[model samples]
Target: MGAAQGDDQDEWSFLFGMLMDDATKRGLAHDELYFLSDELLRFSLAYQGYEPLLEAVADGELSRLRFMHEIWRAMPEHFYVDLALKLGAELLAARQ
Candidate 1:
């Protein structure tokens, strides 16, 4: 956790807040909205990939960012772009 990492986290928070606001404006039921958020959290956890991804990273067969993007590949484009725009900044910072 460095300054830029913290900043990226803040940006992600802002973006998700904006997205949830949009969801409310669209009249999504509270439970539906919650489910949407939960799905994202679940997908994020899937991207972290229990053990295989860690092994891949250790073996140099994959980068963590690439593994994360593989999860993003399963998402809707709009959701993916919204997350990726911020997440990419985080991953890029992590790489450096």
Candidate 2:
């Protein structure tokens, strides 16, 4: 990956880590947290309108909170919830 891409990945990974840590503290399991992070990363990459947000984050024009806010606003609520629940269930099933 190019420098900017690498930096974006690093930044996103850090952001996701924070989210996972928070979720874990909230009583969710690590498997769900990992799946959530992976799905969020994939969504950020595939979402068409996410480029500007990514660029802003990479350029330091946006705080991590702002970037996450934009993502939350951009993604449909039902879709996000469905994705989380589906992935969480899949991971739980695999572990059993």
TM, every model: 0.29, 0.31
Clashes of each: 0, 0
State the lDDT of candidate 2 residue by residue for 1-96, as single tens digits: 346553254455566567756766888654444443444534664652466676775686854444554564444445567899999999999999
Clashing pairs in 2: none
Candidate 2 Cα outliers beyond 4 Å, as residue runs: 1-42, 75-96
Off by over 4 Å in 1: 1-7, 30-96
Write down the TM-score for model 2.
0.31
Q: What does the lDDT read for residue 45 in candidate 1?
A: 52
lDDT of 1 by residue, 37-66 (tens): 434545655543344544564586854344
